[model samples]
Target chain A: MRFDVVGLGVSTVDLIFTVDELPGREVVQRAGESVIAGGGPVATALVTLARLGAATSMLDSIGSDFFGSFIQREFTAEGVDTGGLVVAQGRTTSKASILVRKSDGARAITFSPGDAPELTPDEVRVDIIRASKILHLNGRHWDACLHAARLAKEAGVLVSFDGGAHRYTNQHLSILPQVDICIAAHDYAAAFAGTEDVAQAAKALLEAGPCVVVVTQGAAGSRVFSKDGLDFQQQAHRVDRVVDTTGAGDAYHGAFLYGLARGFSLEASASFASAVAALNTRALGGRAALPSLAETEMFLQHPL
Target chain B: MRFDVVGLGVSTVDLIFTVDELPGREVVQRAGESVIAGGGPVATALVTLARLGAATSMLDSIGSDFFGSFIQREFTAEGVDTGGLVVAQGRTTSKASILVRKSDGARAITFSPGDAPELTPDEVRVDIIRASKILHLNGRHWDACLHAARLAKEAGVLVSFDGGAHRYTNQHLSILPQVDICIAAHDYAAAFAGTEDVAQAAKALLEAGPCVVVVTQGAAGSRVFSKDGLDFQQQAHRVDRVVDTTGAGDAYHGAFLYGLARGFSLEASASFASAVAALNTRALGGRAALPSLAETEMFLQHPL
Candidate 1:
């Protein structure tokens, strides 16, 4: 089946713990509650796209163990196509344990990818890439992502890369030439651009060959630089209570991709994505409280 | 159909996360890994008992939710009897999200018991309680526990209570009179006994009428006090690395009961339980790394 957007990367089940205070050494304190949900940059992004009425597909490898099955279950339940998912025999899939502090929407996360197989270029389905309008990459499987990005570029599809962190080895940077949109965190932008300033960081990243560069600043909003030399700044919608900011970035990235596919201007897309991300911080998890298009519009009209 | 130990309480699926540091305001960090396993004090204790080759039965309420079925699946797979387990409609079984810190063996735990029905006294199977040599009460359903404990006592069966925390309330405390062995954490003992010192806590708790009181001091050791002035202290086996301490206490409780049923002395039983708990810390979850009797004996001999 054809897809609006196809996300290729790792997917995981996140175990979140909400705590009243940071526990002291050798002391036991009770937490408020715990929740389990689907997580991972590409996984959450695809789920968000699906929630936004987009036909999304994910290509990745999950363990054949129970947690792997859980990832698949969440994907299918969320209406994200899992046809491209590979269940490997030796691993147990990736899992993250997240601790959310009650006072603020802050978190400490730990993850283990037990036997998570690395996807190769040979595993990419050429037909699926040709069918998709946009290809989303998280740089998890470098070789596969590079191959897919090149194929998508050649097929006249837009390629968006979510550079989680800039500390990746020089080998990962080699795939940047095929990227059409390079969205990154402030740290990644700074590391790639060699400048700590947000504006300078975006400029440096753009010089790396992307047609558009966007650097996300948590709670501060986002800065976008387009191919036509259009620079715009979008402020984050104010949230009354920030519960957990675990997947805010993923939401922003997914929403941005959706907006771009629907022909929204870069400025409008960033604003819309920022608003959706702000709403996500109102609750625990990255995808739990994702606002619908109607909800997002209403929120824009009467924002908190 | 007879059982050595009958556990009366709730069973849950535990989602455990291990974090590098405690969470702070407006920050995000990745977790190390997530581990899923069977949870709930009595439920886990029963699993431990079954793993140790004891005939164990669980009498509790699980919802008709997916997680509830998952709990039952794990229980049956582990050879624990679930004939008395009640599946309530429109309710989800309990779930626990636990956060473990990397620097220390500290945890923050949260739980959700969605629509889990409380077992009424009428639901107690008198024959089941009478057939068991030890009736283990987790204080989840006070009324049901009281009724079953009374029946077990009348049948000359030893009744053991695992006092989790102050949440059990005074109504549950009233059931203490019918208990033969009362095992509790130091915090639980202080809340129930109104004393902080372990020895004083045990002394004050023994006065509450349970024939024997065992107070667990995390990592320090455990103390057992009897009304007849018999007292003994068992040091915890030194653990080189503690991956997750989620089910250490439950393992100790289960092993203690097993030792008691096997006609071991109080000191020997506590020592055995300490070894079990130490070994449990060497792995993840309460039941995953539970050592066999032979394994425990060798561990104790090696003294690591």
Candidate 2:
């Protein structure tokens, strides 16, 4: 199937419990507003891309379980193609119980990865990768991701990646050479570079091979470091109020990916993505306040 | 404010996700049926008691949050008194995300204790605890539980306890001397006794000061030990099949407490409680298949 962006990763069902603060052991708090929705860096980004008028498709082994059903249904509802998806038998989809602090809208998440079968390299649909303009990835299903990256590279398709807190060091970093554009959360860059400084982290990440590396610092906006020595920074859009920042980073990555597919310049896409991220904080989850292309354009016209 | 039983502990909001098996790290499975209910050792017991036509009330710090509101609303709906409940400011309610295995009905639970304020001795409603015919305790809110037990003792009310797993050894063992009737799951008895044998566990628990100790063994019914040297076994009620056993033990405790209040003999109460536990396993959650007193009595007549 022809596609604009094809994403590969686990789509999690996030059960967000809102509380005043994260509790210590043995402490009990009454939960405030609770939300249940599909979440995961690549999953949310794919949803974001679809929302912004991209013909996106998702490729992952969503187990034949309730959570898998929910993710697959949600993907279809969000206009993401499910033709390339695989349903593994007798497996559970990832479920993340996130505790969102009411005051700062910060969160602590407990992730339960169900025993779904791993997506193998053989499962990578060559035709889907070749037909797709962008093959987006999050560092899960390492072998499958590596295989898809290789196919996308051979097919001359742009290999976009969302380096979200990329903890699987060697596995994730090695795939960077095949990645064309990697928009990462600041923490992911910091971890990848083993440095606290954002600039240094971005520079270190660029050295590892993604030609264009963009590091997103929440509320501080985003910065892009290109191998061609083009460095640009975009200011964050002012938010009227922040309700929940749970999925804002992924929204930024999704919007940024959307921009690249739409053929926008680096600086323009960064600012456009920043606008999308800021507006997303007005709602409870990552997909709650996702703006359309026109809405994002309008948001860019007037800051908040 | 007179009541048949007063319970002291949390009314946890349980999010049960059904999977084929317990997941290992980083695996994903598809979920099957999912259920949400107010559950806890004492809470389920109270719910069972209320369903069986007992005049029940509960005392705890169920904060003014969504889950707390849900529990309080459920209590009011179930005809359980909530007049003595405290709405602690800025606290989150206990949420248990349980993964129920579809194949064997086994479950693995991840409990998140939100930062709700602890219920203190001062918050224990002296009048409510005294007015109740029986006081039920679960090993949470240690100070408040101890205070309520003392009040029940002074008022000559029967103090019945449900020693869940009783992992809090030091805090739990001390509460036993103040307890009158103790009904515990086999696991709790084993933990209390630090032995694998059910008889030894029951005997060991009785020595800690509960005059009556009954240990519930799932599918095997129960064995009761009395300080007066009466030890008797009750056969489990045979069911067509067991669906969910989540709160079967609690149902047994609540039924046993009901039997005593209704003036039944020790042996008769054990059998009656066994009937309640057996019947409760026919549905999705603890409260779903809870039988009315008439239904339970009918089951007792048929012995199933």
Candidate 3:
């Protein structure tokens, strides 16, 4: 495989503001800090992998607006290949205005799904998927995602699925059988399994398809289970300060995949992923505090 | 005078999003609607006057960023002159991310005041202020606002001051004596007068040097008082729905000045201003629903 991971998902520009308090009514308040960064479930995950020295390519359609340019530029800066990306003319790119409260890193988001047309099945980069060791997706661009998953499976490339919080639906079941690795937020796991029980939800998801299943509960930590009788708990790493947890889970997914691609043990992989996720919360945006491969290794060794 | 009004204030790009609910914790929600428009106290006010067929010029220092360009483009599109706008190379323009809840037009704003240098007294555009029928200010650029007010006063141009909600200060007292008309939010009036009584606040504001004083209370209506014994209550016009009130007060100030410029009686001006402010709330942003003179006249003839 030419690339380490190839991702198919929506790309968005996040305008994250660190405010003193979440406003309840009509009021104008100054931001403590502001950051504009590229964000999306798979897009941010791919960036995390790239920042960890993995070669990754993005697959999606974005607008030709200033935000589109910003998204592409950010990917390029982070060493993420955009060869499979499409730019729709005169369209608006997806954007999210996120207000994170300074006290606790809690956030309220308002997103505009831009008018850029979704990537069609024909627009899927078959060659890119076939050349990657793994294909990552978050269920955006339904047709294109399904098409890419089948293509990756056919090519013997590992297919990874990220079930973000509040992003699960009945339609996801059809794609699950093709997904080789499934990582989900606890919310997605419960909704998908129709059970709030963590172990039961993991078992149900494992029975559906993927050899491995991980259920992430923010701060409390994460649980990993595999069909081959592997099970463990990965404690959430403590940080001096969690400035924003906007993309912590995404970081974990990317780092976990990086561990697999590097042939690490499941235990080592989860530990590395946990460290990466913890480090990412040091800044105000999703990818602002992404640590490089060496930094992650040093952090893992130091156990921060 | 070559211009009807000259304004000295900061200009900003407002990214307004209408969401189902303001998020209290970490959550992503789609916006019901979104709008990108120019916003500022004096900036929106000038756009209001220009839309109503008054010649207006804006004087401020904005950045050389995309937002700065948007601000200038908006001003030009609204027929407000931009000859006095100084584009500070490579600096960022002020920006506000506003989330307005759908159920109510209540807004939560996170503003990033850009690094654009404030306009100095030398950049006051004296000729523009002298050429205008009215010099409008909201105490943004301290030195420049003071310089322009004195210049307008010296040239026999009427001086108008807008004391926005929570925007009053002792520094404003120095500029008040030069002002001929003062329109203030109830909050500003109370702060300035150290009293919550509407009548007393208006009287105190009038004594500060403006021959005329108008104290505005959102949704409740506004009270107008002049040193010459003209007093009246301008009731708030009822609209079918209030989309967003981001620029309602600014609209009122602009329309009132437009009335004065068109030589309408004080009562007629307040009535016209009230209608304009109500109409402005019919849209999501500050300038989206600004009405022309004909529209205002028609609304006055048959109000909702």
Output the number of the lDDT-best candidate.
3
Off by over 4 Å in 1: A165-169, A196-207, A238-242, A265-268, A297-304, B12-34, B62-70, B87-117, B122-127, B154-157, B163-173, B184-246, B259-278, B294-304
- Give a tens-digit lDDT track for model 2, residues A90-200: 777777666666776556555667778778999877888888999999878889999999999999999988887645376786799999998888888888878878779
lDDT of 1 by residue, B75-173 (tens): 899889988888998787777666677777567566666677898899888888888999999788778988898899889999999988555466766
Tens-digit lDDT track of model 3 for A1-304: 3899999999998888888877766677999887778899899999999999999999999999768888898899899999999999999899989888887777878899989999999999999999999999999999999999999999999999999998999999999999989999999999999999999999999999999899999898899999998989999998888888889999999999999999998899899999999999998899999999999889878874
Ranking by TM-score: 1, 3, 2
Report the C-alpha lDDT of model 3 over B206-289, residue by residue, as the tens digit.
Answer: 888999999999899899999998888999998888888879999999999999998999998999999999999888898899
The C-alpha lDDT values of all candidates are 0.82, 0.82, 0.91
lDDT of 3: 0.91
Docking outcome class, model 1: acceptable
Sequence-dependent TM-score of model 3: 0.83
Clash list (residue pairs), candidate 3: none
By summed lDDT, the worst window of 10 consecutive residues in model 3 chain A runs over: A19-28
Candidate 1 vs candidate 3, DockQ winner: 3
| TM-scores, each model vs. reference | 0.84, 0.59, 0.83
Better of 1 and 3 by lDDT: 3
